[model samples]
Target: MELLKKNIHMNRQKSQAVMQVTLEEDFNVPDSKADVGSIIQDEAGVKIEDMKVANGQVMVTGAMEVEVLYVADNKERKVHRLTERLPFEEQINMEGAETGDNVQLKWDIEDLSVSLINSRKLSTRALLTFSAAVEEIYDVSAAVEIHGDGEISSLSKNLDMLQLTVQKKDILRIKDEITLASNKPNIQEVLWKSIQLRGTDIRILDGQLDVKGEFFIFVLYAGDDENGTMQWVETALPFAGTVDCSGCSPSMVDDVELSVASVSLEPRPDYDGEERILALEIVLDLDIKLYEEDKVEILEDVYSPAKELKPVTMQQVYESLVMKNFAKCRSSERVRMENNQPRMLQICHSRGDVKIDDTQVVENGLKVEGAVFADILYITSDDTLPFALMHGVVPFSHVIEVPGIDGTCRYSLKTQLEQLSTTMIDSEELEVKVGINLNALVVRVHKEDCIVDMEEAQLDMKKLAELPGIVGYIVQPGDSLWSIAKQYYTTPDRICRLNNLESEDVQAGNKLIIMKTVEITD
Candidate 1:
């Protein structure tokens, strides 16, 4: 007897770890730059350089780029930007991790603090969190059919499973330019800029993946006029393209994630040789995972009337997608400035960052709790410091309805800032409106016992001869026709034909007649 088997491809997370570290550095202002008077705005970004795995640990090396916008301490009191790079190295302990294993790392800036140490010196500190996961792909072989003419009686089961089709990492480079409007002034020097991805959508197609999104860019620069006035321009750029992905089709399910890896913005002259075009080169990293649903019939149990068959079975675990949902949460709050802070004359620009603090699984839903950190840049009342920055935190709690959600279900949630705006209510109070989008995917894991192989041997003549040839039986709970036929060393068709039964449906306490038949060999 031979067993026909099928292979199922899958991936599992081998090890995962999360760590937080604080990076601090002190810098002295260069001689070319003026002394630091007061800090107006600060931003920090984390870039990973290299990661090495050995001896069940991952050594990560990276640098944090910090930019500080402050007022000069000289007579001009103008806004000057100071940039620095702080390097960091850390080791994360992950058990069972080996070399050549695929590792994924994600990082976030928890908090950033900048303080004026002296007239010419500054101190900066940033708290960052790094999450690492190692994934391993493998295949499982299951027996689907038995090929032999040995009077074999087998039981089969139909299963709905998900098969992994494509797993890869790719980069999408987007090159575009944003031109200054006719009413806006030409750029002299760009002091600060912010770039963010909004409303991004990714879909799977035949042999490719479609990506569409809009990115918002805000630039604060000094104009080229005689007085060198400071001007700001903001615009949204729409992007649409296709990525070549082999073995991808519309029938497959995709769980692809896209993130801004790095961004480069440079000022270029337009056709008239004026600095009116902002050249943008953005690199987006994508993590792709595609799955195809399959319906399979596999042999669960097997027996032979002419021989002894012992089947080997093992428990296998697989994941099936349950639901995918996209939800939105809207919130508004009023922020009051402190008594010692400067009074706001007019609001210039506003931006926000979302951080998810905790997520809990409730009855048929998920509860998410987080805060939106808003940074507002506005014009001050004083002439010496015309621009000032204010920070506020708006807490939000929302429940996303996910039917059939449970604690055992595995889920992933990604949050982004959809829209943020601020309205000045008074000189000291500002109303902030926030719109957030949440994307969630939930999957359930199943464990099933499957037969992999079987061993066959000759049956004893004495034991075979002692069995009864005919009998009357009463069906009990949890009893099927296949089980009764297997117990009596007969076939289900023979029993049904002798008892004049229409179908194989058997109920408890039902009467049935069974007969045994032996194959005659010449």
Candidate 2:
């Protein structure tokens, strides 16, 4: 007997590791910039430069970009900006990782603080966390059929499975231009800017993918007027594009994650030769995985009545998608200013980020506990310090509905800040509204014992001769026609024909006759 096998392709995560690092550094003010008096606000971002994988370990090299806005100590008390890059390297221990493995790295800035050490020096510190995962793609060989000259009795089953069809990484670059309004002044120099993406949507189509989103851009710049006063502009820009995804169909399920890898804004001159046009270049990185459902016919068990047959079996693991859902959490809170801090004159801009603290599987759902860290930039009542920053945290606990979820299910969650807005309730208190979006994909893992190959040997003629040619038997519990025939060295068809049975079904305590068949080989 020969075993016919088929290979099923699959993609899974091999191993994952997370590392946290605290970075602290001291930087001196540039000779051209004014001396810093006090810091107002700070922004930070992490960029991965290179990743190297070795035996059982991975090394990640990256840099943190920090921008600080502070008031100068001069008589004018002007707001000045300072920027720096801090390089970092971390080695993570990951078992079963090897060279040329596909590794994905995700980073977050937990906290960033900047303090004024002296009139010319500043101290900066940041807490960062990095998560690394290695993905492996392989094939599982399973027995589907058998081909041989002997009469083989086989049992087959149909299994529902998910097959990985596409696994790749691609980039989409969005280019657009923003022109200053006719009423706004010409740009002299950009001081502080914040860019964030919100309400992003990704759709899978035939041979392509569609992406649509809007990014909020806020820029505080020094105007080219006679007084050189500082001016700010905030606007939301809409972006839409498509990616060419070969072999992708609408029926397939997609698990795609997108992030803004890098962005830049350049000041350009308009038709009148004034710096009115701002050129924007944003790069989006996408990690794509597509799965299609399939039904496979597999050999479950095999036996032979005329010859000795033994099947070799092994265990294989498979994955099935349970659910893919998107959930949203809305929260509103009031932030009160401290007695020592300056009161808010008017709200300018607001930004927030969502951090997941814990996630656990509950009854038919996933419980998510997290907080939103928000920063509000506003004009201050104090004439000496015209601008101020307020920081607040809004804690949230929500349960995402996922039917049939259990401890054995594997899930991945991605969170994003869909909307953030701030309004002044009073001079000392402000109201904050936040909208968070959570995307989750849950899968079930199962193991199955499958027959791979079989070994054959010659039957013993002496033992066969000692056995009786006919016998009477009574059906016992957990008895089947195939099992009874195999136990007596006879075919199920022969037993059914002798008993005049309509089907292979048998009951306990039923009387049956068994006969042995001998095969002669030359």
Model 2, 134-249: lDDT tens digits are 76777878899988886777888876677778777889999999999999899988899888889989888999999999999998888899867878889999999999999999
Error of 2 at 491 (Å): 4.8
Question: Model 2 compared with the native: what TM-score?
Answer: 0.91
**TM-score (C-alpha) between model 1 and the true structure:** 0.93
* 231 Cα displacement, candidate 1 (Å): 1.0
- RMSD over all Cα atoms, model 2: 3.0
Tens-place lDDT per residue, model 1, 1-522, is 789999867556679999999999999988888898999999999888898998799999999999999998877788888898899999988898878876778899976998999978889898889998876777889999997985788889987766768878888999999888898788888899888888888999899999999888888888888867878888889998888999999998787778888999889999999999989999988888787877778898998777888999988877777777889999999999989889999998888999898999999888999989999999999888878999888888888889998976877788988888899999999999988888887777778888888988887667667767788999999999999988888878878898899999999999998876753333
Which candidate achieves the best TM-score against the true structure?
Answer: 1
Off by over 4 Å in 1: 457-469, 516-522
lDDT of 2 at 222: 82
Cα error, residue 98 of model 1, in Å, equals: 2.5
lDDT by candidate, in order shown: 0.86, 0.87
lDDT for model 2, please: 0.87
